[model samples]
Target: MKRHAVPAGAMLAFFLTLTGWPQCASAATPDGAALSALWGLPFAGVLLSIAVFPLIAPAFWHHHFGKVAAAWALAFLVPFAFFFGANVAFGTLVHALLEEYVPFIVLLTALYTVAGGICVRGNLQGTPRLNTGILALGTLIASIMGTTGAAMLLIRPLLRANGNRQHVVHVVVFFIFLVANAGGSLSPLGDPPLFLGFLQGVSFFWTTVHLALPMLFVCVVLLGGFYALDSYYFYRREEARSRFVESTPDSASFGIDGTVNFVLLAAVIALVLMSGLWKPGVEFDVFGTHVALQNVVRDVALIAVTLLSLVLTPRAARAGNDFNWAPIEEVAKLFAGIFVTIAPVIVILRAGEGGAFAGIVHLVNTPSGEPHDAMYFWATGLLSSFLDNAPTYLVFFNLAGGEAQKLMTTGATTLAAISAGAVFMGANSYIGNAPNFMVKAIAESRGVRMPSFFAYLGWSSAVLLPLFVVTGWLFF
Candidate 1:
């Protein structure tokens, strides 16, 4: 597939401007304490555009989304430069790029590229049982291969299996809810927020031990609900069901092409782990942001893995998967704006009781000045629904007193609540997590008729909100 020139060129320009800028003598970053909540309007504006524009003006949104994103980003940056000085504004932009957006987009691009090359071949009917099995399998692998990797690898086959169905939108929706979000709750490798925790000194298996029950509870409920819903639809579409059955070949069997891509997936995971574990005590400062040697190695190695998959995988496998670059391209451009606009919001959140959002800070603490576990769950989850979950997780992580050992032991409940909230609630919106949008884009490109952004919010609120409430009552 041909690359989209606009986003690629925009990203290149962003990186060059970030790295090539001169640093200020004083390391004056945006002081969250000095900022007001009004500073967050641009971030909120961008998020609203993401939610509203597609439904009201599909053509305009599709054609000019990059420009919209950039406009919102500049809405924040221009004011920020005027108020905070160009040096501080540039520093903030550079920090956001080097430390957050770059690594994020790189990992996503690699996973999307590699997973797109592996196609599942065979004619399979989308029976409730079969669909449930695919969801279960995708959920099981999400933590191992990441939500992005697992979603990209399996979505095409799942779509193909259900191609003959009259009612298939629910299948893709549940896939996003389960495989693309909740499934990633078990390990740091499973979700970006958890991986950020790992980088912040949380143990590799801490989430596995802490969040297993909550994750299992949510998955079981979702899977059971999906089965009942799918079975109902399957019965109603008797004509479509017969067509699917007739098209199926008795001798057809399932097999995976480009199996070698699995090895590259493993390499991707290893590179992530290595970046967290193999710190070489070396660093490079890009503007005011510090770039570590190990992270550099990890990013480079991931790029190499992306190249290797492109070289080794047969073109036929990708063609069968109907792979294209649009999903990744959309993610890279939109999140560039997200990461940029989100900077002030994060700074304000980090400011805690002294910041303009002090009321939010107060809500997460008890009358006794103790961490409120349920509130932590809800607050983190709510913020994570709109903002990127990784930084939201980091905000609550630090708010809960950023001591890894203490959190693992004495503050275990708080940490688990934070982890569960960030990972689970990411399904609440398409833009909550990276994989959610990519999954939606892929499904829509294949004619799945995905729900508009607000409609999806309605789905998650109806389906997932009750589950989260139950989980909080039982565990948090």
Candidate 2:
């Protein structure tokens, strides 16, 4: 489906937001302890479909991925409603749509829209030094303007710089590593999980204070590794490099278009901060879900900011950037299905020892009843690899005691471990974070020939897993 066409999952979400489909007046949240492991199969199916379909049936997947996602969503909802009652099913759907999916897509759309409007006017040759510099600059700004914002703003320019190169996959992969995931470790604005922490009363700068060393360690190692790898490829493909060097002028002046979007970018950041800092103790009920007022305002204003950017940005700027809504549309549709099916899994994890995944949950606590920092790191990291990292972070956060004051003080290391795991390991898969897939799409659109799902897993397993082990041992 095209960007203008709302997929089945998105249509359902929009319908629910405008007019809820409540089967009853009131309904309680699902009791995770009472649910079986079988309830999680649909969620697993959706993830597997994401991983396998494009590899096995590229044409069909490209044309009908949204229908596939909606099918898996119905697989879960149909059975749940048949067994659990319509009211419960409706309540769960409403909660997922209102509380999580809508807000998630809204913020991403705002970031994508605002950043896509800002175009870098000149392209530099993507040498090892230049690529490394762009990656480093992205990493630095990611914590400031958000990983999505930084990634969107820079990916086009980065791709344009390397358009003549034969060996470009590693460049984009390292971009995902630095800009999309690891670089977002230091601040709430950097990633969704950290933002959730801020909403839960974890101090704004707690991650900045606690995670700076670990972030530095990981970024430095990855940047060095990327430089070495890029140098190898650059020398191997020297012919392509020579052709590009001959064609391009050394005096091609660099400038930025759509500079107004930078101010809009700040507005995006301010809206997010305002949502966390300005709490009016007011909420509106949608079906059984209570939507907070500040969040509502934030979301509304974000949509306004998105529209404003579209109006103010020059047509030439977007055209130069090759901007389109496809990446954001794919994320919106796929994640709608993910949030729906992931509900039971989140509830089960929240049930702690009483739930289906009790063994996994128990690993984070020692026999002495204290939290295990390393276990928290790995468990949170591994789960965040597949589940939405924001909610996964919350699960571990609450497991270690949800109090922000306690987690920031006595359990500081534990909190840091959870934060790091949730932020860093999101690079493990295209589905791990929103920007990973968006970056892949944009690179593929530019003919980068990115890796498939399993191949990408191989990359992360080899490179990121070992580094994470070292990080766990050294920091946790």
Q: What is the lDDT of residue 379 in candidate 1?
A: 95
Q: What is the lDDT of residue 428 in candidate 1?
A: 93
Candidate 1: segments with Cα more than 4 A from true spot: 1-26, 236-243, 246-252, 402-406
Candidate 1 lDDT over residue span 1-476, tens digit each: 23222222244445555776333433467678999999889888887887788879989999899999999999999998888777688778888887878887788788888889899888787888999999999999999988998999899889888876778899999999999999999887788889778766798889999999999999999999999998888886655545656233445587889989989988998888788777667766555577777877988999999999999999889998888887788878888888788788778877878888888778999877799999999999998898768767877887887778899999999999999999999999987888998899889888899988888989999999999999999999
Give the range of the ten consecutive residues with the poorest summed lDDT in model 1: 1-10
Candidate 1 global CA lDDT score: 0.85
Error of 1 at 98 (Å): 1.1
- Mark the 10 consecutive residues where model 2 has the least summed lDDT: 1-10
Q: At residue 338, give the lDDT of candidate 2.
A: 82
Q: How far off is residue 118 in model 1, in Å?
A: 0.7
TM for candidate 2 is 0.90
